[model samples]
Target: MTSHHPAPRPARPVADLFSADGRLKAIPRKPARREALLAHLAATLFEDGRDYREPEVNEALLAVHEDFPALRRYLVIGGFLGRTKDGSTYRRQQQPGSPGGAIFAVA
Candidate 1:
């Protein structure tokens, strides 16, 4: 006798995670989804090779979600954004094998 299993659901597109007004409904709990969200945020919200102050970062993040702090922390922790020792500045991490430190890609 053979056992049957259901096929897995396809992952939601990153754009679907956001609300109609463009705010992220919530930070994804799943690791892969979260990473994709962070990468999308990093690519769209930040420019390459430009350093940003804490408030600047907050301003940009706030445009997407009210919980900028959590978003900020996740960005840093996920290796998508880099912060200074004292957390005074942040910059988007470059994509691997990209010349002149280009913006990171999602996949």
Candidate 2:
């Protein structure tokens, strides 16, 4: 006799985490999922070489979610975005093994 097992479900796309209006429904509690969300936000919201002021960053983040402050903090902490020593400017950090190399060290 052979034992039967159910097939595994495919992983859901990150885009599904957002609402129909493009706002994030909720922040993921899982570290891996959260990192993926942060990476997507960094890639889409901020430019690689451009520097953004705090207000500008907030504006962009606010477009996707009401909790802009938490998203901003997560982006910085995840090394997906970098801020100047004075915290006046913010820019997207390069991914590891990218052409120019990563600007900020990822923990």
In terms of TM-score, the best-performing candidate is 2
**Residue pairs in steric clash, candidate 1?**
none
Q: Per-residue CA lDDT of candidate 1, range 33-99, in tens?
A: 7777888999999999999999999999999999999899888867778999999999999642234
Clashes of 2: 0
**Model 1 misses residue 10 by how many Å?**
5.6
RMSD of 2: 8.0
- Candidate 1 residues lying further than 4 Å off, grouped into runs, are 1-11, 96-107
- Runs with alpha carbons beyond 4 Å of true place in candidate 2: 1-11, 96-107
Computed on alpha carbons, the lDDT of every model, listed in order, comes to: 0.82, 0.81
Instruction: Give the CA lDDT, 0 to 100, for residue 21 in model 2.
Output: 96
- The per-residue C-alpha lDDT of model 2 at residue 24 equals 99
Instruction: Mark the 10 consecutive residues where model 2 has the least summed lDDT.
Output: 1-10
* Per-residue error (Å), model 1, residue 79: 0.6
Question: In candidate 2, what are the lDDT values of residues 1-107, reduced to their tens digit?
Answer: 22353433245578988999999999988766776788889989998899999999999999999999999998887777889999999988885335433244345
